[model samples]
Target: MAQDWQQLNEQVTALLKTAREQVLAKMQSPLTVDEKTNRKDLVTNVDKSNEQFLIEQIHQIDPAARVLGEEGFGDTLQDLDGRVWIVDPIDGTMNFVKQRDNFAMMIGIYQDGVGQLGYIYDVMQDVLYHGGPALGGVFAGERRLKAPANIALADGLIGASGPLVVHDISHMQAIVHASAGMRVYGSAGIELINIMLGKTLGYISYLKPWDIAAGKVLLEALGCQVTTIDGQPLNMLSSNLVLVATEKAQRDILQIEEDDVSL
Candidate 1:
């Protein structure tokens, strides 16, 4: 079983590596950008192509595997049971089509509701944050990572979305206000990378499964907590206000938002 799982990881990693290269090769291709909900929520043909490629690979490898891809090409998943592969073919699609520097490709594999593997590829930088709780996560190009200290909200830098900071959703302003300082990266993948590196104590935002899947595995392995804003378990199929923080930071964060905050 372990060997089979390892083989799956390698196969998925190969697909991700290929997807990364394909996006890089088409980085400056003709702009076929469009909006999802608003102009800010962008998607491109590259995102579609990448997701399609990955889904095909998963189907060929494990026909029973369900893929939750960012590009609306996966199953209408209401439950996250059985073997599921959550993928963000191109995170930071806005950055991908606009600046092309801050995007990422992410994949998270779960077996019967347990996180088995996670991979986040920073295409331009060529860094892959991969591994699992079973194997312990790794940066894939560096020495073994030390799990970040269990720090409070005020102990280290925090990451958040720019709009949330301004809008003060769920008292996000108050949460970061108690922190030493706040950093808004506008890209979930980049912000998550900061948390994994122990550069930030916490990162909170309204995130979807694919948006936070890979980060969830890597950060939790580094002794961080990834859950809802109120310290509730994450619903893999639903979008919620996601909180990624150390244990000490969790209490400080849950206090910032009001009671009954999940909408």
Candidate 2:
């Protein structure tokens, strides 16, 4: 069967909205939480239920599509051979659990490794940032978003992982000193949203495919650069030290030495 991405995008958007409603209803109840890889890496029953719900809906909409979900509810995908849906049901699980305000839900649809549609839903804010190459423009809620200016690192704030700064990984400290300011947002989706809205010039972190897939699609569609610290292409199937930034900020940040050298 031939795929109509336009129609599929609309259907997926509606599905995501409905999923948001379902998740919000569940949030009013007490949550059952569990540890994943470490104490800081957490998952709740909401995460599992949401992933299951999303995978089920994806199967209904496109049964042949391969779904890769953060909660392990989907397939063990080896490659992006066909239609693939990468999902993070509850990004910022810790925020969802502790704060409940900074979390988001994200999905990225790809065809043969090419991004087709992307969505990042700020569950509490009711703001959905979505679109892709197929859609031609990204949007926040109903308003179409403009591409962020190609600003320099010294002129804009940078979002980073707190530990990255504490540990001084890849000269992150020097990069921070070069930026106008810094923010530590626990959620990757929210950090990406900040960059998309021009609130920050860039965001950097060690992120898995599900954590970055949707953001990569939306950011790149808006002419932002999404790549590794060393300017390498991101592998959608692997975890990476991802950097999402404006072109100028990316160039400036990449120029810094990887060692503990001052800026």
Candidate 3:
């Protein structure tokens, strides 16, 4: 399984590089863009094309795996009962279309509802954040990353989505008061990367499966803790306010739930 996995990783990395080239080439052309929830929630031609490309590659390797893609490009998933590949072909789609940076390609592979492998590719920077539960996480091409310290909340920086921070849901107002500082990156993949490299102490936001799937797995493998804001284990198919923190931070943050406001 290790050898097979190594080969698969190599293949997936190559594919991500190819997709990056395709994305850059397409950026020079006019975009076929549309909105889903509102005007700002955008999707572009590149998003659909990238999803198609990745799904094709996945089919070549594991045709039996059920694929859930962000662009409505795969199976209509109601449950995570089988082997599933939860994917976000372009995680920061708004940033991709507007800023041409900060977007990422992420995939979380699970077998029988248990996370196995997770990958997040920061395409523009050419950094692939990939790892498995059986193996430690990696950054750049060769550097082995160390797990973050399980720091207490008041002693560390908090990585939070801006809207959530402004609203103070889940007593995030109290959370904000307890943190050393606050940072928001608008991208789950990017935020996860910072947490993995010890740039931030924790990340919390309302996230979907494709949004937080690979990230949660990667963070957990790097000695970080991930759970719902109320301290329950994550349910893969639901959109919920998720928290990724070090062990000590999790303990401190979970206490805020007692006075948290429901959205």
Candidate 4:
């Protein structure tokens, strides 16, 4: 029998809300922090605990589904075969630890490598950006989001990873100069939300699958483009220079990069 995804969406939404609340309550106490790869890449006890809690709930809801999580608490998935859930329990661990805000919980549901549903929850603001192709449209809270205008890159703000801009990778400096301006919010989920809200024309970053998975589903549902910086399809299991933008913005940005290369 096929799964009732709408029913599952409702169930998982409630589960994520409960898990977020529990994590928030613990935030009032002290945090146990550790460095992942470097001092800039930090993780706290909350990150691990939240991933564990989410994975446990996912197991209860769909034991057959595979879960890929940031904290390494979920399954070791090599491919997106059957039912799979890609999750980031605390997306901006740095922001969560240092600023206590601007973080999110994200989940993307895929079956046979096809996206079915996506969710990005702004845990501090209690805003959820969710839905997917199967849902017919994406939503902010209960309000259905309209597809953003196809604004060109030069006319709208762009959300970018600060490091990418500072290091000038892939002519990122040139890209920033061509945009109306740039905003760095530190959380990929929040940055993607900015694009969904039409607050930013686009966002670019070197993102892992878990980082962009949920946002990719919702972005595509809203008629936005999610692809590599060179305008290639994103690999669901590998990191890439991901760009989520309106159609026109994507074309404009890629053209700008191309022009820079020619010069």
The local distance difference test score of each candidate is 0.83, 0.92, 0.84, 0.91
**What TM-score, to 2 decimals, does candidate 4 have?**
0.97
- Which 10-residue window in model 2 sums to the lowest lDDT? 254-263
Q: Ten-residue segment with the worst summed lDDT in candidate 1?
A: 254-263
**Arranged by TM-score, best first:** 4, 2, 3, 1
After the best TM-score superposition of candidate 1, give how far the Cα of residue 206 lies from its true spot, in angstroms: 0.5
lDDT at residue 170 of model 3 (Cα atoms): 78
Count of residue pairs whose backbone atoms collide, per candidate: 0, 0, 0, 0
How would you encode candidate 4's per-residue C-alpha lDDT over 1-263 as one tens digit per residue? Answer: 23488789888889988988898898999999999999999889999999999999999999999999998999988889999999999998899998999999999999899998999999999998999977889999899999988899889999999999888888887887888999999999999999999999899999998899999999999899999999999999989999899999899878977787521
Residue 17 lDDT (model 2) = 92
Q: Rate residue 261 of model 1 by lDDT.
A: 32
RMSD, model 4, all Cα superposed?
Answer: 1.5
Q: Candidates 2 and 3: which is better by TM-score?
A: 2
lDDT of 2 by residue, 1-263 (tens): 22487788789889989999999899899999899999999999999999999999999999899999998999998899989999999999999999978999999999899987899999999999999988889999889999999999999999999999999889898999999999998999999999999999999999999999999999999999999888899999989999999999998888885444664
TM-scores for the candidates: 0.93, 0.97, 0.94, 0.97
Distance from true location, Cα of 179 in model 4, Å? 0.8
